[model samples]
Target chain A: MFDKAYSGKRLDRDDALALFNSDDLFGMGKAASFIAENLHGKKVYYTRNRHINPTNVCVNRCKFCAFSRSAGEDGAYAMTIGEILARLAATSSPFSELHIVGGLHPDWPFSYYLDMISEIKKAYPRIQIKAFTAVEIDHFTKLSGLGLRGTLSELKSRGLDMLPGGGAEIFDSNVRGRLCPEKIPAARWLEVHEAAHTLGIKTNATMLYGHIETYEDRVDHLMALRALQERTGGFQAFIPLSYQPISGAIDVTRYPSGIDDLKTMAVSRLVLDNFPHIKAYWIMLGEKICQTALYFGATDIDGTVVEEKIAHSAGASSAEMLTTGEMINLITKAQKEPVERNATYEEVSI
Target chain B: MRLALHPERVVTFIVDRNINYTNVCVNKCSFCAFYKDEGDEEAYIIDEGVLMEKIRETISLGGTQILMQGGLHPALDLSYYTSMLQKIKKEFTINVHGFSPPEIAYMAAKAGLTVRDTLAALKDAGLDSIPGGGAEILSDRVRSAISPRKINTAAWLQVMREAHLLGMRTTATMMFGTIETPEDIAAHLEAVWRLQAETGGFTAFIPWTFQPGGSPLGRTAGHATAADYLRVLALCRLYLDNVDNIQASWVTQGIKTAQVALRFGANDFGSTMIEENVVKAAGVAFMVTKNDIINAIRSSGFKPAQRDTFYNVLNYF
Candidate 1:
């Protein structure tokens, strides 16, 4: 019983559910932990990359996000290539990888993003580019009036290395309709990533936490990713993003939350044990908790983020920059050796 | 873990901010509003300089601990955290309350060390205590659906258990009203209770509702009402007999709910975060003043005292 997946245990689904439904905290924790130890041997993973969010200007203002901004907001910005490069250039050392994910700008064609990646590659040939999430790809393809294959090929040729697993929030349209009503639906998010990986572009996946998502929604989210991972083997790692209550942008504050929402964070590590690397993103969770997250069942710490704005656009108040030394410090303090990896978890520069 | 022992004292307080450090995550919960995908043109990773500065600010404004957290990005490693803790301890005398169960879990796996070893290293680096992040609903059913990549409830407990067994202190938290039933919440409490019972390490138990925004889930119409929050609070106080302190979430239910929580079971006020992100990203707008928190607790019939991350009373007001 202990060796099998909880789903496969001898306990009747009813009994398991009842056990789950039971108020016995210790029993339940023991049961869950028993499963955890059996699956993961107690290790976590982290990364060493920087997120360069060049703009906040977007066409799809998903209600679930407090980060996106209309062109008119005082904070709304579309940083020029020079501005972004200048900021990224200040990174403490040459970043091993460059992470790029952003909104679906209604006007910016796919060429704009492709140009950015191409220019980045041209400037820093050693850096691996993990740019564009599934949503951005879908949005780009739609704007470019091209097929998924064609779009991916064109982007890859222009130095687009891989994709970041974003936009596959919940595969359930019911939930998607309520949260991000206008963005690409679950299938679209999947198709784009599938296309990218089919083209040999590896990607990373993520989930947003502390929101109105249902348990089934989370299960479906993972299953969808797992299925895709099984199919293309393109997903490199999985990360969990905590929801912030950004008031003015999307009105997410009307809800309630605290640290307990972290159940979502832990469960992800437990359930997705099959996934090779799980990251504790420092930017959203803060350095302290991110450091601590390693013990539970995580492995990656995202790299030296040079430029980022989404969480801040919503309400993240932590600094947007950390020296590579600082990155190493977080890992060392957590008592782990920081092994820097590129977009694909392949050692780039550690 | 040793037999569980509820702290000799029971102190509860009003809850407030869930101040996350970064939204640039690798673990993207379907329900999160805080994380921005790489090219969303708004994605960001928090700055360490600002974090140090915020620690100073939180300490100055009579703040106790900073609830620092972020997404699972792959670049940062153990060294990054050690220095942060070192700096916090070096700069200010504040309790360096940092890291959650999952974050600890991450380090152990990446460093290829045992949980105990990882925690020991963190403690030696000036880590004062652990905060309960990544314990969403405690039930696997809920976790798998929403955050499959996060450490599961059992693993989360294992880390806490290991931490406690090693004499590292911790806190417990719950975010309800999303996909879980009362039983799930109760089970969540039981997980903490059992761990606290075994290790006697949990300093406090905080239960709050889910805030849905920027997530794939629909917009939350109305959160668990104030009365609902109190009911849960009361239940936590009553059922989590092993955990000594209960906290009210002002960040969720507001000061009024926090005030009500004191009567239900809360004995302490949560952090006055000089900064918060995740909940704010979800679109919530709430904050607390040190004076206001003390007044709220005092009015609620408990003597107000400020405690650091470890529940060590810093001062009595």
Candidate 2:
């Protein structure tokens, strides 16, 4: 399997399953690192970006979600366009991207969403807006009385540069039904992303694992993303979010161990061969594990996320933010070159 | 290189139980989660009956030794240790791989004796060998920052030297991934390598990461990932060429990464650790049966063998 991966052969689902089940973690890591080095030689991409979660009042009650709150809950919040812009203006550091993702607001009209994007884009013209997940797009389609493509085009016209990958938790229907029963089904979620790709809007992909998902489910999820990426080449990166345990309907008592995190990263890098990038989202994987992941085929350590609310609400113990200096230090200490990039992964001059 | 050195393609592990005889400690190292204050209600010195029971269970389970280590209790004296060893030796024929350099140095200081005299006394009481513990990183700077009250680098090496002169074998350990630089790691390896070169008393090098879950230093240091663990494992093998064995830490890195360590230059699979407290006190535990070790090693494409405290194969599965 290592030789096959090294030879640049596409791994079938069975091969990916075998790799997942195999105990040769270092061998798999070496092969995955070889492939990563071939694609980007010792260059680990990061970004100076701020995550803007405009609201936590979500309609879908995901069992694994700790961020979403029902309307009028004590911790619930919905930011106005003016407030979001003011928050962005408060930060003095320069950033090339504005990562905007939030819950599906039940009462807000589709025009409110479009105006939020346009207003942010108008205020910060150069900062690319990578906003929304496929689930959110499906919500917007229903709200605006438009099709998935039309809704995506509308958002794109209003300055949405790309899509952030959330809500694609695990594409298996049985698990998805139990995890987020109210959210869109896997077919609709995939259809929405395919529509976004058809309209030329590149997006990222993600899978939430270590939460009641089997190796077969993980391989199926990766294969689904691989199949889509092969058809549209729209995915800019693959981020595997480790399941963080919080008090909720899902009765998880422990976080995924470091072995599971590294193996998942290596397996994703090998399975998603068409993906140009695999991110070790430091907010979710912590800094040390994220740094260690560079040698296990991760090409990105995400960015200096000014404030991360989603994972933190889910009981993530990592710091809410990292300074650009700290991000560079982490990458450099891992013996990799840190390249600051924009949302689309174009190298940004620092 | 690993295959060349381990031509037999065999991975070995010891079936032992790590028995912490006491939890009362004076050093109070920040990276350790097992130590307690002398007056704490939870602190204890193992009762002889309980200790004997543990030994009987271990012997029944095919264990050849009991890896006994404990915190540096302020009140314990040389006779306390000697009598404990004498009692255990009188009861069972099990090899007693007990005490580390720090404990020895403390015992020596409390007894108003030299390290050599203390080691000679312990050996006379039937301490077959020493298990490497409390040698977090063999750099004085790192030691002072983490465990200032413990023995210094020179003192640790001196105790090891004394034990070597007494004709006893001891293993060297490094607990890294706590505030240590690459240079500190190099210094640690150099110290162990130089000591082995001089005395040839070191039997193996066991490198495990510091589990930061329940330790005081956990707030500052994160747990080391498996990749970092493997990288350090490989580096230990490549650097400590004079050392004969490298043991993989399944306790901290879990069994999967430990299996991968076979390729990264680890020849021993560490102990079955029927009971482990230090790392578990830090809120991380990977318990494995003897069958688990054999299966893991076999699945990793190597023959699994059970060894004694001295790394001699007793049985192959």
Candidate 3:
């Protein structure tokens, strides 16, 4: 019951299931907003970060390969370290974060990522680098022939910062086998995040919903992430990524409705109490729905991302860039105070 | 998301008592059951001793204001009202939020004075603020339908306008769910909004449904439901944007609905209401203590703050 959750009691599987099944959508949203307000006051968090995909070339081409390409593909491109640094330098506005996530390039060595982060840190030491996903980390571990812990530590020491929660498509094994057969399994993703948590590196988590996933599958995926968060307390935010059927593999014709997006955000806020933030990624949910999301338990609207490629490649409709003023305007219109945050969820005073 | 445009950090309540000074009436409103005939045995005006004891009780309970309202008694003139307020101010250091516009208008008419003169006299007698009672709907057609003898819409607005010109703040209320239409509601809101825009003296807006069980008018065929109440409440929050606070009528809506109303845009919980008789006379009474209000707000995930009649927060619980 919401009364139980309102009292700060830990919700169980049944409670989450009931909430997902309940018809009182407004009630659930109010309860979630109440909890969110208590945690963050009236402030909605955002980040001024650049989303740089180092390389879109990958070894394995999964069905949902909108952003990834095979080695011989004409559109496949890889940014050299010099190009990456130049791109970062060319941006007119300063950013507090460098969000890097890309394909699992088989030809590139793990040292390439290590050097990229270290070079970025050396040049822009003030910028917090939140790079790589659990899948990408798994790729690095396999490519380097080292244990996951050693690979993560090596990367962390070499200025590889926190993980961005991508590639966490629906964690159900059946759905995983069908959608991303070549990617790492759900357990490996959890294991990589757990290892990262042990190293005191806070990371975000995501769930790909609205395609080929049942309500139970979604609940199960959320519970698994919740269980991990309960142990580590290291997830800085939970993002429920709505699936975009922009590729040839999926058969959906319509995007998730605004109600579905809002419900997903609200449910994630309610289900993941241990996670400090729930983000409404404007790149995926669009601007209107994302603005409405503030009232439905979304504490963070990801940011004024200067150049985001992954979601845009997958048919995201939001602008590729938004000014910090525009982001604040959107939040202010929603009756929330906007707070700029860094990769680790620290409020950026500047 | 932000719950309010202003996004007040804490929800507020007032630990006040509603003190009805007299039940004797001159205007027999059909919707009211509390007022009695002048010669009735139960129709007695509160004496100074009883009034002082009530103020002492309120002060002992940590209350900061006394919400004093009563019927438009036939024999009581303007002097009686002023002397009573002067006596309370001399004896106690509490804020006196007394007299609705209807009572003030009635006294002005009885004393053969203008509304402005009546308000100035009352203000000089330590009447700090006014309550928004008897304002069923600011439409004369609806007012005539509800209770023909009650002051018309113009009289109510004129009294409030005059009071504001005297630098006195007041609250505005609506009693809906009887026989009014959507147009009636809009007109009522427009009048309140326009007045508020001109004077900036309205501190809050409160809406309560008409309870007909114990009324001489008998039970009405229909009334606003809980969902209807929420819709109207949210609409009030949107329409009366200049009004700083919108209260949840917990006295009529019950405590639970009031808790949920915090999300619907009600920032204040109205009052602790150590004693209330107007709504009780209509056959529904919801009792609440200071702790009850505090817990209700806390359970709804808001910081509970105690406030005075003027909307100044006195304490945070």
Candidate 4:
């Protein structure tokens, strides 16, 4: 049944088990490469924009996050529309898109965020505002007492360009329960994103790996996203975030291999064959590894982050503010010419 | 492999742009597939004008920094390094996060200078920070097998030590699961531990597995499993007690395993690297838009924060 469900070409359970159990590292790599070659030719893509975290102050302090804050920490504060626009203006880089996400702020009204996007468009009419995660949308719904589609539509109408994929840690409820008791369940996260996609807003997908989750959970996470993508075809990309166990709930001293940094990237390229782009995300992986990863299957990297916060508070390594040249140098070294992209992935040069 | 995320809570960025200033290298490592020989078609080292043009385009599209790395050629001594860095810095307030330790060691060796002196020279030239590139595996055995021409483990540590000692905090990296053992990995951490204890110089510890694409370590060359990568990544967090940040190696592992890694010991989701190339020459291909990263992180139940080289938080949104 499972084989037929995945199309009549599923690896037998025995085969899957053997692959999982095999101690031969090269053998597994060959299998993955063969699968990737058969599934998708080595084509990859990227974009040029900024990651705007609206707020770090959150109620859900997951076991894996180093970016969360307790309401108001010394380094944690929510961004007002003015502050975001000011930072955006400072770059003066012809960013076609603005990637925005934030914590589940308890105090702010949902309309405030819509206003942020509306004002961004007001200031830079040409820039696309790819903002909000399902979590934020869900929070919006709870706060404003509106349905996901209604909220998403209102935002889109008010200049919210698209949805930036954010809150979807793990699909498995057990894993979700263990990692973040405060976060909306995995099902709800999916439901909200699905609702947004139904409203004609394209979105991305993601999975967090290495922590308490098992291989089955990893496969399940991919399968769920694949199932959803097959249905909606709204997912533009799939990103794999490693569980940041430092200064978070999971103590590395207690459990280390949870940070399966290398495996996550390789498998994501191999498994999410249907997803067009897989991101390396230098902020968490660091710049050098992300550059090195362009070959491993991650073709698109998130842009020149002029200013970032959540990851830093948790202890990410890379510049807080990136300039134009750094982005070009990284792509050039990878031997790939860098192209600018806007929200919805339109190439933007002018 | 996982399902499409219900993009929700985390923070992510976009893609686009790449700029490599120079490939002229005096120190060639076995793992590097990007560097070029003096006269190769891909060998021409980019000059200031060429680099400036590239930067101009990237800037035209919101590029944030230029990762300027080149060879440790004897001809390109302190003046060359400073001049090149200063040129980029002067023209634009770009983050010049360039130069591996081997390049530093080479320049230091050439200029009758210490590592600290070489770093100071570059720092004065507007270099933001150093990348942990040359510290391959922190083990001389792996060092000897791969790039004998490169500096030894001791020298790598010394360079990082000097950089840290001079107050130039940097990241520590390890390229593992290649002709190495758990003991070797542990030993690598021990070395980092000693240095971090003294200087607290490390901003993060990134452990990536080797890619055997076009290098001497071909397709048949050994590579680690996702589990192995996780084991090492998580272990680095556990053992490298001094280091605070443990990034997921999505560059090598792809996104799913990287997501899986978040549970093990990675707190940071890592960079939204707009562009990259070094690993592709070996073999690995994964890509992420800024939104994808945020969704991936948020769905995983963590608040994704966009961070910088100095570990400063930009904004919470």
The candidate scoring highest on DockQ is 2
Tens-digit lDDT string for candidate 4 (B1-317): 00112123333322223455567665566677766667667776566676676666545544465566666554566887788777777787556667878888988888998888888888888877778888887788878887778999999888888888777878888887567777888898999899889899898888888887777664445545554566577677778776767777666776555765665577666665655443332112223355556656654445677555665555443
lDDT winner: 2
Q: TM-score per candidate, in order? A: 0.54, 0.72, 0.55, 0.52
Ranking by DockQ: 2, 4, 1, 3
Where does candidate 3 stray beyond 4 Å? B1-317
Model 1 is docked with a DockQ of 0.03
lDDT by residue (tens digit), candidate 4, A80-112? 888888888887666667888888888899779
User: TM-score for chain A of every candidate model?
Assistant: 0.84, 0.98, 0.97, 0.86
lDDT of 1 by residue, A1-350 (tens): 22333454333233333432233333333444444445444333345577887777788878766677888877787876777677778766666778888767766877787788778888888777888888888777787787888988988998888888777766788878887888788888888888888889888888875467655666667767777887888777888776655434443433222222233444555455456666767777655445545544456767667667777666664568767666666666554567666676665555
Clash count of each predicted structure = 188, 0, 1, 149
Q: What TM-score does each model's chain B reach against the true chain B?
A: 0.85, 0.96, 0.94, 0.86
Ranking by lDDT: 2, 3, 4, 1
**What value of lDDT does candidate 3 attain over all alpha carbons?**
0.83
Question: What's model 4's TM-score?
Answer: 0.52
Docking class of 2: incorrect
> How do the residues B183-270 of candidate 1 rate in per-residue lDDT, one tens digit apiece?
8887888888777777899878878877765567536422344435666788888888877677777766665446545545677667
What value does the lDDT take at residue B257 in candidate 3? 60
Residue pairs in steric clash, candidate 3?
A294-B1
Candidate with the greatest TM-score versus the true structure? 2
Model 3 TM-score, 2 decimals:
0.55
Residue A103 in candidate 2, Cα distance off native in Å:
2.4
